[model samples]
Target: MQITLIAIGKTDRAELEELISIYAKRLQHYIKFEFRIIPDIKNSKNLSEAQQKEKEGELILAQLQPTDTLILLDEKGKQYTSMDFADFLQKKMNSGIKNLVLVIGGPYGFSEAVYAECSGKISLSKMTFSHQMVRLFLVEQIYRGFTILRNEPYHHQ
Candidate 1:
C-alpha cells in the first residue's frame, strides 16, 4: 500500500524540512510514500477559525481519491506505541488498501466535515508541537514503524 502524508502549509525552518526529507527518502525504501504540502489558504486572516478549517478541508478532500483511506493526526485521537503503529500499517497493507492518507491539519485543526470523512485518527502525543515540527515527527515515526516491522536497528525499545 502507498502512504501519503499531507500537511497544511510549508515548513519555514530549513532544519525541520531537511530532517523530514531524510525520513521521507528512507520511507521510500520500505513502501511507496508521498509527502504532500498543501498550500495555506490565502487571505486567511480575514476568515473565522471555523471558516478557515472549512476551506482547508475542501482542499484536502480534493486531493483524495474515493478509494483512499483517510486518517487524521489529531490530538484527541488514539495514541499507539511504535510496535502498535507498525502493526497498524501491516494490517492496512494486509487488507490491500491502495492508499493510506495521513493528514496534519492547519493551526486551528480539522473541520467537522473532515472529521466525518476520515476513516480513523491518530495522536502522536498529548502535547502539541508546531505545525512544522509535527511534519518531522510524523515522518520519523513512520520510518521508525517501518524499521520496527522489519526488525531493523533503526528503532530502539
Candidate 2:
C-alpha cells in the first residue's frame, strides 16, 4: 500500500525539512511514500479559529480519493508504541488498500467535516508539538516503523 502524509502549510526551518527529507528518502525503499503539503489559507489573520479550520479542512478534503483510508494525527486519538504502529501499518498493507492517508492538521486543528471523513486517528504523543516538528517526527517514526518491520537496526526496544 502507498502511504501518504498530508499536512497543512510548510516547514520554515531548513533543518527540519532536511531531516524530514532524509527519513522520507529512507521510507521510499520500503513503500511508495508521498509528503504532500496543502498551502496555508490566505488572509488567515482575519479569520476566526473555526473559520480557519474550516478553510484548511476544505483543502485537506480535496486531496483525498474515494477509496483512500484517512487517518488524522490528533492529540486525543489512540496512542500506540512504535512496535504497535508497525503492526497497524502491517494490517493496513494486509487489508489490500491502495492508499493510506495520514493528516497533520493546522494550528487550530481539523474541522468537524474533516473529522467525519477520517477512518481513524492516531496520537504520536500526549505532549503537544509544533506542526513543523510533527512533520519530522511523523516521517521519522514511519521510517522507524518500516525498519522494525524488516528487523533493521534503526529502532531499539
Candidate 3:
C-alpha cells in the first residue's frame, strides 16, 4: 500500500526539514511514501479560527482520492505502541488498501467536514507539539514502524 502524509504549510526550519527528509528517505525502502504539503491559506490573519480550519479542510479534502483511507493525526485519537502501530500498518496492507492518507491539520485543528471524512484518528502523544515538529515525528515513527515489522535493528524495544 502507498502511504501519504498530507500536512498544512511548509517546514521552515532547516533542521526539522532535514530530519523529516532523513526519515522519509528511510521509509521509501519499505513502502511508496510521499509527503505532500498544502500551502498555508492566504490572508489567514483576517479569518476566524473556525473559518481557517474550514478553508484548510477544503484544501486537505481536495488532495484525497475517493479510495484513499483517511486518518487524521489528532490529540483526542487512539494512541498505539510502536509494535502495535506496526501491526496496524500490516493490517492495512493485508486488507489491500490502495492508499493510506494521514493528515496533520493546521494549528487550530481540523474542521467538522474533515473529521466526518476520516475513517479514524491517531495520536502520537498527549503532549502538544508544533505542527512542523509533528511532521518530523510522524515520519520517523512511520520509519520505525516499518523497521519493527521487518524485525530490523533500527527500532529498540
Candidate 4:
C-alpha cells in the first residue's frame, strides 16, 4: 500500500531536512511513499487558535482522496513499541488499503473537524516535540518499520 505523510509548514533547518530526506529515500525500497508539506497559513498572527485550526484543518482535509485512510500523529493517541508499530504497518498493508495517510498537524494540533475524519491516531511519545522534528521522526520510524518487517539488519531487536 502507498503511504503518505502530510505535515503543516516547512522545515527551515537544513540538517533536519537532509536527515528526513535520507530516510525518505530508503523507504522507497519498501513501499510507495510521499511526503507532502502544506504551506503555512497567511496572516496567521491575526487569527485565533480555533480559527487557525479550522483553516489548517481545511487544508489537511483537502489533501485526502476517497481511498485514503487518514491517521493523525497526536500526543493523546495510542503509543506502541517499534516492533508493534511494524505490526501495525503490516496489518494496514494486509488489509489492502490503497493509501495510508498519516498527518502531523500545526502547532496547536488538529481541529475537531480533522479529528472526526481520521481512521486512527498514533503517538510517537508522551512528551511533546517540535513540529519539524516530528516529521523527521515519523519518516525514520516508518523506514525502520519496513526494515523490521523484512528482517533487515537496519533494525536491531
Worst 10 residues of 2 by lDDT: 136-145
**Best of the two (1, 4) by TM-score:** 4
Per residue, candidate 1 scores C-alpha lDDT tens digits across 1-157 of 9999999999999999999999999999999999999999999999999999999999999999999999999999999999999999999999999999999999999999899999999999999999899899999999999999999998888
Candidate 1 whole-model C-alpha lDDT, 0 to 1: 0.95
Reference-based lDDT, residue 123, model 1: 94
**Number of clashing residue pairs in every model?**
0, 0, 0, 0
Q: Between prediction 2 and prediction 4, which has the larger lDDT? A: 4
- Residue 152, candidate 3: Cα error in Å is 0.4
Question: What are the runs in model 3 whose C-alpha is more than 4 Å off?
Answer: none
Give the total clashing residue pairs for model 1. Answer: 0
For candidate 1, report its TM-score: 0.98
For model 1, the superposed segments whose C-alpha errors exceed 4 Å read: none
**TM-score per model over all chains:** 0.98, 0.98, 0.99, 0.99
- Encode model 4's per-residue lDDT on 1-157: one tens digit a residue: 9999999999999999999999999999999999999999999999999999999999999999989999999999999899999999999999999999999999999999999999999999999999999999999999999999999998877
Better of 1 and 3 by lDDT: 3
Q: Give the Cα error of residue 101 in candidate 2, in Å.
A: 0.4
